[model samples]
Target: MTPTPDPPATLCEAFQRTVAARPQEPALLALAGTALTWAQYAERVASVAAALRHLGVRRGEPVALMLTNRPEFHVADCAALHLGAVPFSLYNSLPADQIHDLLANTAARLVVTERRFLPVLHAAAAGTSVRYLVTVDQVDQTPEEGVLTLEEAEARAPRPFELAAALDCVGPDDLVTLIHTSGTTGRPKAVEITHRAMLSQLSGSQQVLKVTDQDSHISFLPAAHIADRWGSHYTNLLCGTRLTCLDDITRLSEALALVRPTLFGAVPSVWQRMRTTLEGALAEADPGLRALAEEALATGRRHAPRRWKGVLTQAERKELDGADAVLAELRRRVGLDRARVCITGAAPAPEGLQEFFHALGLPLTDAWGMSELSGIALIAPPGMPRPGTVGRPVPGAEIRIADDGELLVRAPFLMRGYRGESELTARTIDAAGWLHTGDLAAVDAQGDIRIIDRKKDLIINTGGQNMAPARIEGVLRESTPLIAHAVVIGDGRPYNVALLVPDREAVTAWARRTGIATAAPWDTHGAELAAAFAGAVADANARLSRAERIRVHEVIADEWAPGGPELTVTLKVRRAAVTGRYADLVETLYRRGAADR
Candidate 1:
């Protein structure tokens, strides 16, 4: 059977229809305290679309969007599609040099950015093919004299000209957007998405999530990533649901309270940090407050045992009911009540973290996807969330594990090909339409798939013993309070040693409790550092298997950064990078560096 084609050619048509169906429904909100109805949002999208056409944007041209999580970013994206232009996003966190390289490679005609990012654009525009620089907000000056404010262009351009008819030119095969993966190991590749691909993905997502116009979600993940765009922005567009955008993560808690969103998407790193923050604050809190928080978390853990399988035991269900009442009060205190489903993606979240929230009556759903698949391949359903599994494949998608334990996927949502890299694309997606996911996964008789780890990321010691670091890391994180990332290194060595990055806040509280002289856990405190970190390592080792256990862990003082030998651009730990950087330290650890302790 053929898949359904993408509708809403100009985005104007799709949105206008939605507005007509429910004109008064709120469509968009910002953490900065602004809301727009569907009717109002469509008008803005149309005005922006008209503006882009007036600026000489042609169909098939690539428009680079370099803005943060503001309303204009979404408007600009919809406008690009309206004019049949492909929108490519650049991470705002990137330096101007990286931005220049991307623009030069993609040959983008225009660069859409926020006013605050004008200087960076100007720096990149010193001498480039990029002619028209479009800034969403007011700016004093632009690097390129040809720069046009989005406001100016929209106001000056006449009302959109028969957009519904103009959209007839776009086909399902037309490129809808371009996203550059962080490319932790190599140069970023541009992933091209088509209208049909996006629509198919949204269809699969809707079937699993049951999202509708009544649902509101928070958007903060970089749109430059395919997962963030499809899961947060495009899904909302198709469902006619409202999305709240917040550019600053510092204001996330505040944003949550105000928006009271029903859905939210974030990586494990962000949620792990939140857990660490709450845990640390509780440690230093008043005795009464500390006890209350502990009781609440304990009650939640009992209700929803972190390691339980899909079917809850009778005792578990009963415990959950008793725990739910206590957790309800805790939810009110933590401001997580309105967050009906907190979605985790990009990496496997620690299972304990998932159950902690579930016990508290919040659905922390885990999703799996890759850049090539246009974001999601599988998502845990609300009714059947199996711990440690990424849940079932979304509707219309198929997942099969190869004889060697590699997970392969095939779906309409697969990318057309790696932009301008036909050979690489062919190697990834075969003639039979199966995408070799490069991941190792396991499936039970019931069809739930649990991603063990990346095939290449697995560790094999000299004795021919293989281990999945992700599993060990997950267990270790649950055992300790402050550790954020655990990279087990012992491929050719006798035993595994790890480089652990502590949650700065959690470590600080532990240090203070022991009367340690360290100002911060991330700071170098001389000899005392070895003793403090050793204790944390010992605690973590208690939860690991003999072979998987860390012999000793070195505490780093700095946070991990991409291209800095510790982390990938997506904020995932780079096992190879860590080993390369700390080759000398690994030798010392193997020589029984902390045996005396």
Candidate 2:
């Protein structure tokens, strides 16, 4: 079936519509007390546009962004968009090498960034096409030797930037952004999404979310990720949802309490941590109150199905009402009391994750989508969220389960192609136009989809964070000569851990420095080797995100060789074979916990 066309010709048009409707409404808010009305945001965007236009930026040009979740990011991105330029964001956690590769691929001459990322940006910009480094923070202060500031850009506007005339620069087919994600084999693939596709996704999301100017959202994820762009940023342009920019993920708790967002979403790890905290507090509460809370949750679980079906009897409704009363305080304390719909995406939620929240008077809906689809293509309908299933395809998306169980999707929001990878794009979307999602999934009678397993080798951590294991393993090999081979393990786990095969000769040589005898666990020499492995792991982790860092590692006493159980004939690490052989060891590594990294 042909997917529905977006009502707006382009995202620029949708944004203008929203601005007209909510000109005076709070469009963007900073956790630090800065707020911008829609009109003000448009003004700032136009100012940036004038600056970029002056800098010779034109239609189809790429403008890279390395920013935290800040309002300035919105301004810079919109400025690029209205100028008919493509604005793509690089993951803030990406190492200098990866950032450089992305910049080279996009040929982005201009990059809008902040001080925190300037060092990496400067390093990455070396020998690349980058000519302008626009800093978001330190607006009026002296920037790095050759960088311009965000305020300077706005001040350089030749005249009041005209939004109306500038809107004519681009159309729906124009590329909007490039979402960089892990490819099937380990390299990063930049998924190309156009304005039309994103607008379609926003429309489909609106059918379920029903979001409007009344809705307020917390921007927690990096703008580089598709979830943040689709869930918060693009939604603003189409639905007039207010955005609270949370620059630092660590401060999400305080920001949540401060903003009390009406529509919020987080990865499973965040929800899991909340559950742990809630359980820990309940364990320490007064005995009588704790008992009441447990009983209320139990009652809630028993009748939640009836509530979802809207067939709850009077007695059942009263019981649930009491349960709601019992958990209301808990909800408010977590700043989720006002949340009409909460979502978990990027990875499958752990079993019973949905039940825990539903029992607590909160509806935690799970959705499934990838970078290629823009976002939120398949969502567990908030009205009837079922455990384990990511519900039916959203309006305007068609889904089918292939004979091999691979989930296939066709939607207006689907990506046009990968940036500079036409062959890969052709492989992903076949002649029929169905995107092979590479996920093993099942469709129930109700058209709900339950993801069973992944067909690819990418690792998605507990917090719904995705990373390429091959990239990490490559870094590990470079981190230290003592490591013979490194197998990263963190698929659906709380954090990353690694199995490191040590080169015996190299370990023994390194042991000479520490005056250790053998690499035996009983010997003090073992501690020295473990410490060495730890150091290498730390070095590699310095280039990764918190979610991608290896928490614990086990140095394998046995060295791996080509064609061995853990290695291919080509000397590559056979990931599944290595993990399968050391399943117990990997489990032990995770049991050591996520803080040791």
Candidate 3:
């Protein structure tokens, strides 16, 4: 059973209480062996607060952070909270123009970034409200006019301010942070998170996740993302859980093995890559080992129960234990041997990925939430997760499907409003205080919510039949290992078509084996690649309805990445942007079909 969490009036109170309770316990760990105990972390927060105060940061003012997932992010965020200031988070990889726009929107005066981004920051800060730029790393050249290193600022602090008085000024209703939406459909909007909303989310998650002090977490997601901020940062601070900060996301698998975290949270993309990597490793194992592993997985699936009610019979426990033993090496190899709870959110996961992990005795739970909710509104229970559903509504969050099939949620942790967009916020949040989530979803008989797709992304063909692009995209990607992403396009067309992004490495391997003489797989226009993709598309079409079937597809040469116009910072494809950019290619696919007709 989960213990009732002690509610703190403000974030600072939570941090202070945790530090007082576990002063010697590890609070933060970096990839480079930099560790800080709770007490040490608090001392740094105090120093940072003093520095901010010395720099004239007043209460309620926005202090932006453009740093990566490092210890300083926590320090600076907590420092802002300690000063009763709003911490505005910015993705480090965002283009300079976007950064400038956000800074102007928030009127942020001070931004903390790394030395490597100095030039970009400088350009963005020009003619904006930004007055000071602080670097977390050492600079090679002489400092710019308004630039200062964190170490220099800390050394120059006159004295540590009295935090108790500052804490007294902070209240539950005070604005805590400004988190931006992913902007997959359009421009990013800043969501205003308050102290009360944040604490409410922490309480709700605690009831569901049952996170304890003994559990450790690897913080690898982008720090600016609300999932990382609310799920990882706030949860760790409030629960007194040890958090290991990952510097490089590319080395996440290595970090996972080294940290062996008990609680892990990630976006669906990260989970997908991990799954692909594990499956690749299994396929390359010795034939005997591979056969044994497959048999173990099969047995585990056969014995796995549908739901867990927190109690098990002795025989059932023993059987599960045996299955765990059989697949122990496979779990160790995947670096989830010690994980108790693994969660994926921010985007829809591919079908069967959750079940695959569950067969291995690891419940890869799917969750659903947005920036407006402060944190997750729905989370699949550890052992009782339904494959396609995103579980039930969490405590303090009431969910209902609107008449138009939109999901409406009334949560205690809903954002106060969208910053500088009261009209838009009013439209989004109804007078009854329910947030009208733009997602088209359905509540199953068991009350689990299954998101179909974004309302705007829904495809209505010329035949007036509605289809979900996300469903088709997921099927196409899951049908073959070579396909990385799929964007189904048939909004008002005769038939559905798709733009597919191939997995370059997988394509290269196939090309090598098939004798396709091409230096770059992405650049290759070989018949083998086309045939392989055609086979994959056929597999996907076999499962889809006639109206939803992808009739034709063209594989793109370039991969969609963040910082590109077509992909958001969280890597969600901007459907409109992609279609607009590849208008000619999409037209060609349809034009060929018309010619055939």
Candidate 4:
């Protein structure tokens, strides 16, 4: 692979270079067939920067953004960066009070949002430093006391935008953004990322991705999440990658087909859904066709590891040669035909999930990172992915396993510190500069890292049997696509039980195929639905050890979505929230043993 050139001193400089180098290239895209050229994107950023200056925004001030994934978000965020101001995105799913905490913590006085979120923002802004509500879209163009549309802000801008002057003041160590972690344990803490750290991590990640201007990305996940921020915004700023930002994540499948991006990244759940979709369709296919597809998958898997090692025999090479053609069609059907690299991280995927994608000719790369590192610390090397491990560390990351199995990282990508929490930050990052990542991990002799679980999330039963809840949950999700989410419970209990949220589409299809039609509203407690879940749970348990298996399970009645109580915007399960929300149900399951089922 060719070496990447030296990274710019700051992202603002990188953006300037990209705009000068590829002015006519498509930079930002929308689903409605709208495109913004690199020059137009830069123009938008300048306009926003001018408007911000007019509103009294200055260097070192925090600007909070709360909006959907659109070209406007990129424009506004880049505007803040150029102004030497810190720009941070909030999860649209966050509650008014959480927004209150974030604004108070950042001491941000301005919030960029649309009219839909005004009610929530108004409540959050009370008794805080928040003084302005700049809406991207509002019904009335007229300005209110503390609220105005984006157009009005631009209209009030002073002549001769001093964007260049502002950019000149920015430095490498200056704070670029504040990314809040998905607080599974407590309140989300804002991670302070600097220009130097973002640049370092991005350049290091290129060793694995080798990202280039020819690449394209479709953005659906929340920009608040580090993964999407890096994939959609940062990559485009530095590498000139084309970006298609979607407003709604539910339409991700439709957008994927439309963009057919060269680079695709998602949480492990998305890959599981794709695996299930193809498997479900094949389950009902003609016997001959099903057999042929199965044989192709088997052949692909048999050749994948050998090919990854560059050790294919003549006959094995011929077998893969035949299977790849069939697998290529499958890739096209799933809208990954143009994909050069597919990445999955943010959570653990079941052991076989990666191999499943490899069996279809796409190497589903396992990755590992966190908000503290600004994402992508370790990733499976392109074309040489290992199924069960998040591969070797990227260029600048130095990793070591602590005595108690916690992973410690010393990297240029490390965050400056947690925002407004110096004491907590001191506890997290030791005096030696090694960030104590609370994840339990084991590094194999090959230098590949296998994440066991979060150090605090491991379950130890009353009888002293210990296991990782993530591994069990992963196995359950992989047993069938019908199960969308699984929460395992047993910390100090006698045995484990699970709460399963089934996929509505997959479950409906299964019910139709089995002729077990619902008489009334869809009921998760219905005998037929229970039977289906029972089968899936049994299948999953077969793959787990006796201690790790679920003794009893309850299927969730309602579908859990990204913005819901059960899931973070990035689609990671909020274990505490789920367990707390269903405390009564969990207690009931324990009171009435597995015999009750």
lDDT of each: 0.77, 0.80, 0.84, 0.87
Cα distance off (Å), candidate 4, residue 533: 1.5
Error of 2 at 235 (Å): 0.2
Q: Which stretches of candidate 4 lie over 4 Å from their true place?
A: 1-6, 141-143, 284-288, 518-521, 594-597
Clash pairs for candidate 3: none
Best by lDDT: 4
Give the per-residue lDDT of model 2 (tens digit) for 1-597: 999644888888888888988899889999866489999988888888898887778899999988888888888898899988999888776779878998988888999888778879889999998888888778455556558886776687677668776557788899998888763233778899999899889889888988978888898787877888888889888888889998887788899899888998887646765675676567668999899989988988888767877899999988789788888888987888898888887755644667878888777888998889999778877768887788888999998889977899999999999988999899999999899998878888877788765667678877888776756775676676566667788889878888887755455555554567554532323566668778889998997777778778777777675434565322446676777779887878877874454
lDDT of 1: 0.77
Worst 10 residues of 2 by lDDT: 562-571
Ranking by lDDT: 4, 3, 2, 1
For model 3, residues 1-597, the per-residue Cα lDDT tens digits are 999765788888988889999999999997666489999998888898899889889999999998888889999999989888999778877878888899998899999888888889888887898888988888899767889998888888898766676568888999989998856866889999999999999889889889988998888777788889887799878889989898788888888888888888787667767666766767777888778778878766765554244465678677677667767777887788998888888778876677677778787888999889998999887767677889998899998889999999999999999999999999999999999999999988987889999988899999999999999898888887788778999998989999988877666655665667767565636677778899999998999999989777898888788757777777788988999999999999998767877
Q: Each candidate: RMSD to true structure?
A: 3.5, 11.4, 2.4, 2.3
Cα displacement (angstroms), candidate 3, residue 452, comes to 0.9
Where model 3 places Cα greater than 4 Å from the true spot, the runs are 1-6, 305-322, 505-520
TM-score to native of every candidate shown:
0.91, 0.78, 0.95, 0.95
lDDT of 1 by residue, 1-597 (tens): 999655664333555567677667777788655577777777787788888888888889989999888888888888788788898898887777878888888888798887788778878866677988888887785344778788888887876745465457777788888888744464778888888888788778888888888888778777888766886778767778888888887788787778777787788877776666666666778999678667766766665544235466678677666556756765655567776667888877888888766766677888999888887888888745667889888998998899999999999889998889999999999889999988999997777889998898888988888899888888767767667777777776667887777776667777787677775444654566566667767776787777888876777676776434466556777666677777787777777745734
In the range 81-134, model 4's lDDT, one tens digit per residue, is 988999999888788988999999899989999888888998999999988999
Per-residue error for 482 in candidate 4, Å, reads 1.6
Tell me which of candidates 3 and 4 scores higher on lDDT: 4
Q: Measured by TM-score, how close is model 3 to the native structure?
A: 0.95
Query: Which candidate do you rate higher for TM-score, 1 or 4?
Result: 4
